[model samples]
Target: MTTLRILAAGSLRGVWPDLMAAFHHQTGLTTDTQFGPAGLLRQRIEQGERCDLFASANLHHPATLLQRGLATDTGKFTANSLSLTARRDVVTKNDTWLSLLQRDDLRLATSTPLSDPSGDYTWQLFGKIEQAYPGWGERLKQRARQLVGGIDSLAVPTGELAAQWLIDQKHADLFIGYASYAPRLIHHSHLQVFLIPAPFNIQAEYAWAMLTHSAVPLATFLSSAAAKTILRQHGFT
Candidate 1:
């Protein structure tokens, strides 16, 4: 039996099980997945983690890997968009960010802009909206800083971690996470998902590639038509 080791972004959590089972049962290769932030995963590889496959929420991390001679022959696939998510119970008199940002009692959470693409994209999205709507940028920025005043706050990493915190732990009243994570987001009774307006949200593209340390042929198999079908079935695109 071929054993494949995978390092992937946390956003893939909800769909990973299905993808793994199908890949293994059909190709007879068992996959061991280690999911986390794309940046964190990249750091692991840089630290010499022996992983066969690396799929990231943003292509940047993979690009970094290739630039650093850690990965090779990358392939781009799938896409995602940001959503303004919040707890359902939060009595948002405004509910939407357009209105919520101006409120005083709300707390918002997002991944780290420097380390996580989702966080970076969200910041840009918010900036875009603020540009379109006068007076939004000033208040939004202030509100963000106010919400996360603690020094040891969770510097969110991947899109999935954001959703996980909202649902699994109830860490934040509002957060911006991945589009595909919507189904899982619904599990949070107080969580409600909303899309950021066009020009405000970034168009996410998820990519996959092989690690230089790979000992298994999983990367080659992933590009096969059969594998593509399974990924597409799981909402990869």
Candidate 2:
């Protein structure tokens, strides 16, 4: 049996294992998978890394590959939204999601833009905030510390949640990341999860691209009801 090669976004790490297992059971196909920042993975593919399929946290990366002739087809598979994860002690009784972001005394951590879709979405959220509040968005952008998700960013230890690890390590008082992580982060005794409200939040579209004809079966499987059920179970929309 030829094992399918898959490269996926780091955000999918929690769900990919189960997804691959289901894919194998249903189709009798094996897969070898790697997870990392979607943009960095796309860069690797562009540089000639071989994979049957590439799944990204945002549509842009996969679309870029299709446009550049590096992929044969690309389409969205699932969706996610942003949320704020703050250390329990850092949040005050008077704080709202917006206010926590505006406070200068608290450190704000985000993924690195251009190297991660989460960071790009955070910037997009800032843009929406800017539209609503005039200058606050740019201030948030300036204040945000790109702590992880870059080519040279600190490596999050395996089996650890990025938001939890970053906050527990004292890197930041607050982290804006995918809301899909809320279930896991909410259970942490020292963390508080806040859902970013509409008009200020950005929707992250996860897309996948076929790098070779051999990927068609896996790509098709990704869109099946079983796959969607697994995605929803893992907090994807």
Candidate 3:
């Protein structure tokens, strides 16, 4: 049986098993998935990691893959919502990050822009801080610095491990991450998401592509119904 090697974003860690099982059943091609921050995966590919499918957490990541001749565009499959999340304990009395974010003791953690699509969405949110309340971003950032060593915003690893870290360490009052990963964290930890209404929410466009070094048949199969169903079932859309 042929094998399909895929490099995907770490946020999809929760849904990977089902995606692989379904694809294998349909195509009879075994799947090997390498999940991590999109930027880190790109570095591995640049260093000559042989791969078949490229599923990324952001449109730009997939675009970059095709631009550098690393993959073929298969277009975005679905979008994930970005929002602020808090641990259940920290969120009592119907309070949310938007309401308490300006508190002198609050800290908001996000992933590094250097290696995450979620990070880009976080930065975009900072620009729209006024939508929640005027001048909120500056006030939040100032206090965040004194608590977390100094920073305008907080960043954690862009991996599934980071999800556990958030709950284990109680690192910050809130975090910005994809909805897919957020729900899974709740199952295993003390974290919960603050739902940003549609008016203030942002969607992250995700994509799947065919790696240049892959066997054409394997890459082609990723765009087939089997893969699409798997991706969609895992909340790709």
Residue pairs clashing in model 1 are 87-190, 88-190
Best by TM-score: 2
Candidate 1, residues 58-173, lDDT tens digits: the string is 87888888888888768775677887677677655556655655556767666666556676666777777678887676566555531121234454544434555643465656
Error of 3 at 113 (Å): 1.0
lDDT values of the candidates?
0.68, 0.94, 0.66
- Looking at model 2, residue 148 earns an lDDT score of 93
Would you give me the overall lDDT of model 1?
A: 0.68
Sorted on lDDT, best first, the list reads 2, 1, 3
* Model 3 agreement with the true structure over 1-237: per-residue lDDT tens digits: 556778887777766787667656766768788877787777788789988777777877777778888776556655688756676676669686577565555567667665777766666666578655677755554443222111233444544445456646776666666766655566755676666666667788877777754445555555577767766666565
The TM-scores, one per candidate, come to 0.79, 0.98, 0.79
Give per-residue CA lDDT, model 2, range 36-119, as digits (tens). Answer: 999999999999999999999999999999999999998778999999999999889999999898889999999999999999
Looking at candidate 3, the ten consecutive residues that score lowest on lDDT are 144-153
Q: Where's the lowest-lDDT run of ten residues in candidate 2?
A: 194-203
